[model samples]
Target chain A: MTLLSVSNLTKSFGGIVANDSVSFDLNEGDIYAVIGPNGAGKTTLFNLISGVLRPTSGSVQYAGRDITGLAQADIAALGVVRTYQLVQLFRQRTVEENVQIGFHLATRGGVGAALFRPGWVRRQERMVREKSRELLRLVGLESQAGLVADKLPYGQQRLLKIARAMAAGPKLLMLDEPAAGLDTQETSVLGDVIQRINDQGITIVLIEHDMNLVMRMATRITVLDFGKKIAEGTPVEVKVNPAVLAAYLGEAELE
Target chain B: MTLRSTISAKPQVWATALAIAVAVALLAYVFGRGGYVVTVMGFAVIYGVFVTGLNLFMGYAGQASFGQNAFAALGGYGTAVLCADYGLEPIVALVLSATLSAVIALIVGYPTLRLRGHYLAMATFALGLITYELSIEQSGLTRGFMGFSGIPPLGLGRFQLLSERAQLAVFILIMLLGVWVARRLRGSRFGRALLAIGESEPAANALGIQVFRYKLVAFVIAAVYASVAGSMFAHFVGYISPEVFGLSMVTLSFTMLYVGGIGTLWGPIAGAVLVSFLPQLLRGFRDMQDIIYCLALIVILIFVPKGLASLWSLAVRRSDVPAER
Candidate 1:
């Protein structure tokens, strides 16, 4: 069943059309990849879907409810979460603290709770710490929990971003270039983790330039060129499409 | 415990105890000195609360605001008008002033906070200028340039809090409450959210934090602090004037925040005491006092951009390491 549907979505910045008449439906539990050449507006589309940017004209229905023009925080609270293309962990905060911040929406202890009820707040904080630790373990950064996020190696920072997003308890996770700076071994681990997260029933949408990881892990693939969808299908089908070949892979071939 | 853990935990206690000690010292000074010192200390405590509120906004939420003094003026004038004219009690007037300041914050913050960094600074600065102009022109309500007089003093039963000692006691109590509130905010989840937003707003928004709401909350909370300070100052001195809440007071408060530390709670208190009392300390210099004060702040800012709080933290760190070693 379709978990999110976008119809006739259009976004423009003055004269530049970043996304034009884009239409797509994401199925529940589907691991989808959006692949494109540079300036294909993949990130812009993610921003629009995630409510960081309002669509110029169109509708976005998430979990069968129209969510167009909702605030980013509201969208996130609805279990739709996205990560930045650049690593955006709180550098001064510990890795565990960074992840625990994502639990703010789920945390029942407000300012009053933290102030008036120390025992309750301590218990809740401990629970959040345990959850953060578990997520850090899942991302293979359990030992680095106490370390400041910026002190981590670049690869670990990327993994921490994923762990932070996971701490939000997302129904749908959107990652922007999670594999951008990883080595082959780290990429393999990330692929495995993505599959594991999907196996646990959360849907995933990723924008990536890494074709090998995309082809290996994506259940469905959408190809974009110059802000327009060129082709979309099952991984093999999109891989064999001539338009996608001419526009995307052909450019990759040249570079 | 591990040495690292032990060192990390020691600072929290030491810091709290040290703050309480400083507060006690201030209390003792108020009791020891005569009227003039007590009066200045009263002003310092109120301004300390005002600057503490601003520190939360500028240091924690990463929003630059110059209109906090405007809110202070509003609270001062609001309380004066209510109690003197409308026959409300002093405490009721203070509460009303805070609520009014919060409402004004909501109205102003909603639109202006959308502007980024320097734009926010310029916008709020203009708002402060406008508020000052309003105070000057609105003669019927604010008494314009002539200022408001005949403001009533706070009292309970037969004891009027107008005397220097009583004023100091009230100021100390209020300052302690302000510190307690600021400390609470510093450790709360909302405080973390503010810091996260200050670090990177987009990342904070993506984390499901309502960045605008938090910013508004910070702004309003700071305004409330300023307003209460204004009310207390007006009553303590039994006089109110447009000149009392102007750019100079705002800049002085900002300088205090800079000198003390941006995000740390005690920084404002330290800054407030220094800014308020430095001229008196240098009273022997006569005409050169202002120049000396400015030079001192410039030097402090140049050498310690993080403020005096960093120096305190560094000292604590050194002491902590040696003890652990």
Candidate 2:
């Protein structure tokens, strides 16, 4: 099933076009990756789809609903969530607290219940706490749950962001540079986690600069250059596409 | 999360808190007779409640608001108009006035809170100025700068709380209630979301936490708190004045939050008590009182940047360490 469909999406900042006429279809249970050089507008595309930025023109259809200009929170409530490129997290909070905050969408208690602390609210809070812990374990940070988020190591901090995003119960998870700062071992672990998440029936879309990781992990690949789609196909097909070659290599490659 | 486990892990802290609360209550009852000292302490309790509400906005929810005192004025004036002019019961006036303040907050927050950082601060500052002007200019309603007097004391039909000790007792109870509410907020999902928004708004939004709605809720709750405190102040003093809820009160409340520590549970309480007593203590210094107070705050910030709460945490850490030979 086509879980997310982006058609003719265009975004411009004054004279600079960040994303121009970019279109793609992501199917359910597939790992899709978008790769381009620096300034290829990969991150901008993620922002546009996640409702952090509105496109100058075109539409984004998620689960058959046109969610072009919806608020970021509204879109996230609909199960489309994204992690940040720079590891945006609640730094003063514990790792578990970071995850629990992400459970805002799944949890049901409000300010009134928080003030009163009735039995039902306590029960719901307990459930959220347990779920947050389970997510920590899933991300292999169960022991670090008590440590403050900013105190975590660089690679672990990245995993914390992913764990937080997972706690949001995203149906379509868009990861921005999840492996940017990780070593080989950490990258492999992250790849395994991503595969596990995909196997659990969540669609995955990522913007990654690591070509080897993307080529090895992504089932389908979309290539962008200068704010436009150059080529897109299964990784094997995209590896041999002439347009992708020229975009990645040099224009002289075609000559 | 770790919050539940930490609460369970240190059950002894609750015992300490209970003991301290009891001791403070007993001391207040013993010494809070009708005198200048009791009056200062009474004002401390009132402002404690007021600053606790502001802390919820600035510390937890991460919105710096300057218009909180305006809500207090609304509360005081609401009670004055209802109780003194319309002859309604004082307690009913308090509740209605608090509600009116919250409604006004909701209406104002919708437009004003969209501005971020310093912009939001300036807008709320503007709100404070506007409300102050309104209170003075609307002479028929607010009685202009001459103020509203003869407001009835807080009490039920037959049991009017007449003495300073009686009023101090009520203020203490309300202050405790405000602290309790703040603690509850800090541990809940609502508070966690607010903290998340404070730390990074885009992160909170991506997680589907409704940032705007939560900010509005925090704003209104803080407004109601300030209103209740204001109403109680009016009833306690039997008068209302625009000068009571002006820029000076805003500075005092902000100072309290900072001096004690912005986000700590006991920061506002400690800040309120310490700052409220400074003027009285410095009375002999006369012209040097404000200067001394500012210098004290600077010293505290320099030595303990996190506010006085850091000292408590440092002591806790030391106590947790094993003794060496």
Number of the predicted model whose lDDT against the real structure is largest: 2
- Give me the runs in candidate 1 sitting further than 4 Å from their true place: A1-30, A51-75, A92-94, A108-129, A141-148, A184-196, A225-255, B1-4, B11-30, B85-87, B140-143, B316-325
lDDT of 2 by residue, A134-203 (tens): 8888889998886778888888888888888988889999999999978888888888888888888999
- For model 2, residues B1-325, the per-residue Cα lDDT tens digits are 2453465445446545754795577456547445887888888889999988988889888899988999999999999999889988888998999999999999999999999999999999999999999999999999999999999888888788998788888888889999999989988989888888888887787677789999999999999999999998898899888998899999999888888888877778778888888888888888988899788888988997777666665543432111000
True contacts kept of each: 0.46, 0.82
CA deviation > 4 Å runs, candidate 2: A5-25, A53-71, A118-120, A233-237, A240-242, A253-255, B1-34, B283-290, B317-325
Q: What DockQ does every candidate get?
A: 0.35, 0.52
TM-score of each: 0.84, 0.88
Query: Alpha carbon lDDT of residue B241, candidate 1?
Result: 87
**What C-alpha lDDT values do all the predictions have?**
0.84, 0.86
**Candidate with maximal TM-score:** 2
